[model samples]
Target chain A: MMPAALSEATPLLSVRDLTVRFRSGRETVTAIDRVSFDVPRGRVLGLVGESGSGKSVTALALMRLLSPDMAEIAGEVRFDGRDLVALPEGEMRRVRGRHLSMIFQEPMTSLNPIASIGNQICEPLRLHLGLGRKAARDRAAELLAMVAIPEPRRRLDQYPHELSGGMRQRVVIAMAIACEPRLIIADEPTTALDVTTQAQILDLLRDLQSRLGMAIVMITHDLGVVAEFADHVQVMYAGRGVERAAVRDVFGHPRHPYTGGLLRCIPDFDGDQDRLVGIDGTVPSLTNLPPGCAYAPRCERAQDDCRIVVPDLEAVAPAHRAACFHPLEFAREVSP
Target chain B: MLNYIARRLIYIPLSLLLVLCAAFVVLRATGNPIDIFLDPNHTPEQADVLTARLHLDQPILVQFVIYLRDVLRGDFGDSLQFGGPAMPAVLDRLGATLELLAAALGVALVLGIFGGIACAVWRDRTPDFLISTIAIAAQSMPSFWLGILLIQIFAVDLRWLPTSGRGDGWHLILPAATLAAFVLPNFVLITRTSMLEVMGEPFVVTGKAKGLSAAKLLFTHVFPNALNPILSFLGIQVGRLVAGSIVTETIFSWPGIGRLLIGSIFQRDVPIVLAGVVVVSLFIILANLIVDLLLSINDPRIRLG
Candidate 1:
């Protein structure tokens, strides 16, 4: 489980002050608040959040996949030391499949319903790699075989409707790794899948990540998924990062009350059932976010100033930071 | 499949029986058949003698049974006006209408589908705007008016094409274009709408995630998935085109069944008129069945008991 092909130092993607906005009639809604993060080579950065927290928006913003009239974006996104924000559409297309790739959460609706699994896998190679037709087809078969699809050759001629939801997602993963990109932004990749399939997909992703030495941004709402996969973690609320730290530091000594509430919310496998706790209030509407720290309205430890003053990301310990007016008490040991 | 065929076949007889009954009842029930057939100057006694000679003296039940029996045997008597066997004339002209409808539907399918896919892929682009505008404009105009306008422009003034007739000569261009223009918009619009919906699915992004380019995505993905709902639209249009060909055929002076039916209606030749309706209805039903079969194959959801 040591870093295999990756060097110890090298950040593959840098997102800086990326802002995305939507306009409805006369009202303007900023979907993604100015956000920044770094994904190191061969590292898994788990982006944890509740729904409508702009976790998916951050991933979509990287690929420039938002609709033309819907999204207004401005900010710096640099991948492999190259600025992606200002690149022309033509050049960005070349970069999308070759140097960068992404997988969506829904396995069912993600594959083209009419195209054969093989054709879907071969698309990037044919477009960007410029391999000859026979070689591209041969590589497509190889990809299916690598993904462990049974009878890879016959699958080449079979359409997407013939495959189950799990197989279709496997096809999607095969296509993602076809070009062996430097960065793979898998947005809630296992959320739509069954429990057993989710584990297999996670394992496949991790195996491929280490072998390819690719940086992965695993965005999810599930804290349990982060525990199993993420080496580093960033928790977001109201489109802003509230806490970020190593996985050990994050769950072991919970600094932010939001992070503490989130960790307590999860049902422990080996614990007294009565001890499990959940935050009471629902997430506030992004269009009408609460004043001061967005979590203050829901935080039981909120002070008078916490309702008026915003908290910036400040270090609680080495390589650990939280945005909170009052930090939580860290137990001597994690609850396991 | 055989049960379906058998069920449909049963409807054919049941349909013809009703038509035969209507023809018999309406023809005689409205007025004295012999009186209408004979001179008005004749006396009542003369009219009675003439009716008796013509077998109008027979009991109504006896007449109906004999009539139904004759019709079942395909001895549809001569049209009072045309003085020819009804079945042969109906069958001959049904062929002509079928040919026109097939050609028109063929043209509509090719142009509508490809144009729709193009418009959806380039939505909000100039070409998409242009295709949609043309389809809407064509769809808004009456087919009869469109036919007249096309005749005036291409056939009468420009003289580059013939006015009418389905022939080896340059006669098909205008009428075929007339039918196609009417059918094309529904096809294009349905396709465009469905294609837009399919394009919006998260899977298209998945396809993009797989690194598919514009051309491959449209043909392989967008076009096929969008094709499902449009099958019903296409079937409905085929039936409309068959019924609609009456106006087009009349305007163009084409000797198809529509023109024949109009002539029969003028002559009070009810048998041939009924035959025309029957033929067109059969064609509509058949086209729909074929379309349903194709749809089941495409979507894999629809199946028969």
Candidate 2:
């Protein structure tokens, strides 16, 4: 038997060399390139990137929700000592909802419009747990209350359209946690909400993660949310993770040029800078990517070598890595 | 919800009035039926009698008023071909038409929706292409031709069932199938497109992420959202089926309202023609109203609106 301490140290979910490519006509585009990370028990790992950085695709791939016909997925998704990528679909279904759940970006569209909020939440309970209707309904009511929805009983019969965006998202979260999943992959869960509601939802998620002891993969482009909630951070550029480290290390010493550029884009409250810094150039087309580092064209310090050799993730610190030929030194990092 | 229905109901009377006015003007302008009723060598007295009987000698405006009054009072006048009140003659044959419509609709909807969902689920694959080709063929073929072909194969050649006329349940199958085949393509295409659209929606992604089985996700989540457009298309299809039965019923010699309508038209039976138009129009309006009500019930957003 494994030691208790060793078992405790093992991450709940570990992804290695995850790659996803989409095919359209004759061209194949890599949406997620060699993405790898870990979500330890009861910890929050924020996956941050701009649009088209494969952040959403990574989450979808982790859930095995992407269409097999359109996307060709490779790599290992090891969850609880099981290799998920190799699991048959029938087996995967059992893992989903029971062990893993995902909250989508748009709350308005995530919940089934025709279904009542309670029914949607009760679905996973009924499907995975095989609970009878009455038991499921009672549990659904409990979940509504757990998500902090007022008048949970009355709201049970209300459809998704009848609920506000914030309320709808809470219903989505309630549904995600209905079967008490061990891990929840929330893809931009607050992107559709207002600022106040966004903060509240994030706070709720953090609180729920602690209470339920469920690890979370929070996929978002908002670094602010990442800073406040994430225990570890993975910064994606193009289709690959350019930097992966503890949240403080990622913010305090951003080694990848892409990560440093992204940090500079964030506005400082008391800083006298006239304008927030912006990353130059757009993301290269996935179908026709450059041979080297995807960010080489956009990196201010791009050398001739940076344009030719694809950099593999190299350790900059213990458990901290970056996929860049010329990583920023500690002195050159934007002061945290 | 009741208020929304009431608001929609207001359009019914307005539409009926317009239909009636158009039918009256067109019928009057087509010919002086009194002249046709009399021979060229006939006496003036015969002409006078025909004119007075039809109330055509009155001013057009007065004639319209009388016609409207008679219609309101349920006197659709006499059917020149059927030897009775036009309304009763039409209603008598209505049972057969309704039966045929119900059978055809059942076949069309079941096949169409199931076929559409299958195509969407297996999209871009061989099954999708195969089913789509068959649907297109079914849609393009003329119902009357198809009916005859079915009769040739099933009734004439195989001698499995009766060729024409309606009595036993078995007699209804051929005509119903023909009608169903004619309308099935629209249902299949509409349902497929609607389902494909909903399949791409974020909620469907959410449904899948919830670990729902493929069948469950499609039927429970995607199907309901896709249903609104399909239901609206179904309303129109219902009306089309009613109209289409005219051809199918005629070919099958099914003794339906459509056959009676054709006989009345041949005899220049003004009352029967006008009554048929108004009744069919009413049916169309009712179908639309039902579709709207069902849509509102299924989709909460429409109810809220």
Using Cα atoms, each model's DockQ against the true complex is: 0.43, 0.75
How well is each residue in B182-268 modelled by candidate 2, as lDDT tens digits? 889988889899999999899888887778999999888899999999998988887789889999989999999888778778878
DockQ of 2: 0.75
Task: Please name the candidate that would achieve the greatest TM-score relative to the true structure.
Answer: 2
Query: TM-scores for all candidates?
Result: 0.82, 0.94
State the lDDT of candidate 1 residue by residue for A170-232, as single tens digits.
888888888888888899988888999888888888878887788889999988888888889
For model 2, which pairs clash? none
Minimum summed lDDT over a 10-residue window in model 2 chain B is located at B33-42
- Top lDDT prediction, candidate number: 2
Backbone clashes in model 1, listed as residue pairs: none
lDDT of 1 at B165: 73
Which tens-of-lDDT digit does each residue in A16-102 have in candidate 2? 999999987887889999999999988999999999899999999999998887899999998987888999999999999889999
Model 1 CA deviation exceeding 4 Å by range: A1-9, A131-138, A273-275, A329-336, B1-84, B91-99, B106-140, B145-174, B274-278, B293-297, B300-305
Query: Over the stretch B1-305, how does candidate 1's per-residue lDDT look in tens digits?
Result: 55555655676666666766777777677567665555668888888887775567789988888777766676665666666877678888876777777778889999999888888878889989999999999999999999999999998899999887767647766887888988899888888899999989888887665556667777777777898888988878886887788888898887899888888877767557656666666677677777776776665434343
> CA shift at B252, candidate 1, in angstroms?
2.6
